[model samples]
Target: AQPQEGEIIGGKEVVPHSRPYMAYLKIKVKDRSGSKPSSCGGFLIRPDAVLSAAHCVLKVTVILGAHNINVQEWSQQRIHVTDWVIHPNYSSASLQNDIALLKLRSRARINENVTFISIPRSNEHVRVGTRCRVAGWGDTSVYGSTTDVMMEVDLKVQNETLCQQEFHDYQRLSMICVGDQNSGKSTYEGDSGGPLVCNKKAHGIVSYGPSGRLLPLVFTRVSYFVPWIRQQLRRFALQELPASPSSQ
Candidate 1:
C-alpha cells in the first residue's frame, strides 16, 4: 500500500515485503491532537512490552499492528501504555543512550500473527559484514514525509573501527552501525527506535545517524545494554499483572 501523509513509505512503489516483524507504534504525546497521529516503528520483545528508542516515547501513545498508514485496522488490539521508561543516561543533544521500554496496561493476546522477538542475550556477538534486516514505517525519500506502510531494508554490519572513525567523537560501545552508501536504502528521522533484527531475534535498536561525511543508520546494540535492560525489567515487574492463562 502507498503511504499517505504523515506516513512512512519506501518511495512510490509498494514493494512486496514481510510485515509481521514490524510493529506499528502509535504514540500520543502530550498536547497532541487526535487528528495528528504520531507513529514510529517498534518490535515486540515481551508478551506485554515493546522496546523502542527512548526519544520515540516523549509524551506518547502506542498502537500495535496496522501497517497501512491510511487505515486503522490494527487499532482493534491497541496497547495503551501505562508507563514509559527512558534510559536514565539518555541525553537529547547527543542522542546517546537513546533507549526506552513501554509497559502496557494489560497483556497482549498472542497468536500466530502476534508474537515477541527474542532479545539478544548478554555478550551475543553479531560481527561485521553480518547481513541483517531493518523494518520501519519511516520516510522512504529524504524530502518526502513518513509512510503508512512498513518498509524493510537489508543491511550489513560495519566494522567498529570504521564506524568510530566515521561517526567521530560520538560513537560508543552502546551503538552498532549498518547501511550501504551505494545501495540507495537507508533509515530516516522518524525511523528512530526501530529494531535491527537477525535470525528473528532483535540485535539492536535504531539509535543514531549513520557515519562518514553522510550520516548512516546506527543501532544501539541490545546485548551491550542487557544489564541495564534487566534492571528496567525488574523495576517494571513491581507493577506487572499476573500472567493470564493464555500467556502461561
Candidate 2:
C-alpha cells in the first residue's frame, strides 16, 4: 500500500498552551537559495537547550515557544541558535543517532508558556502497546500543506521485531517504531525532530518514516541517549566553569 506522505497523518489540533515544552523550529537559510523557510518540531530540554533530530540542525535560525505558525504571541520566544551539536555517530545515510542539541544564544524566559520537558531514564523502557502523544505543526495529510496551528495525535508503541520485518535496516537497540498497523496513523516529513511523550516523559525523537507508506514511523530512542545527554550537559558546564585562582 502506498503510504501517505503528509506530515501528521490523522491528527487533531492541539489546544493553545497545552504542550508548552513543544518547540516549533524555523530554519532560515542564509542565502534563501534552498527551501525558503523550512521548519521542524522539537522540545525544550533546558532553559537554553533544545533536543531534536540531528537532521533538523541545519545551518539556519531556530525559533522556539511558538504555538500558531501564523500569529506571534507574547508567549512565543525566538532565538538565533548560537551553536548546535549533532551526535558524533549520526549518519546522514541511515539516519542513525539522529539526535541533536541546539544551544540558544540566551536563556529563554520560563513562564506559563515555555518550559522544559523531562527525559526518560536510560533504563526506562516503553513497551509495545504503550500509548504516547506526539505534537507538531506539520502537514495534516498526504499531499497537504503544513498547518498554521500545532497538531497532535495519539500513537502506540510497536514491537521491535515487527518493525524490523518492515524495515530491513531498522536498529532496534537505538530506535523505536510507533503506529498502529491497523489504523495507519503516523508522522510525516515536517514532523521530524518532534518528541514522542509517554507518561509525561520524552521517550523518542521523531526520526524517519517509510516514504509513501503509512505502516509505522521510526524514532530515535531517547532512553538510549540519556547518558549522552547528561555527558553533554556536564561537558558544557565544565567548559563554562571559571578558572581556579591557583591556575590563573
Q: Which one is best on lDDT?
A: 2
TM-score for candidate 2, please give it.
Answer: 0.91
The C-alpha local distance difference test score for the whole of candidate 1 amounts to: 0.69
What are the lDDT scores of the predictions, listed in order? 0.69, 0.82
- Candidate 2 per-residue lDDT over residues 189-236, each given as its tens digit: 788999999999999999987767766888999999998888776665
Candidate 1 lDDT over 26-119, as tens digits, reads: 6655564454557677777776678898878855555555556567564335767888788899887777788888887777776655667888
Runs with alpha carbons beyond 4 Å of true place in candidate 1:
1-21, 29-36, 74-76, 210-215, 241-248
TM-score of candidate 1 to 2 decimals? 0.82
TM-score, one value per model: 0.82, 0.91
Flag clash pairs in model 2.
3-212, 3-213, 3-214, 6-142
Score candidate 2 by lDDT. Answer: 0.82
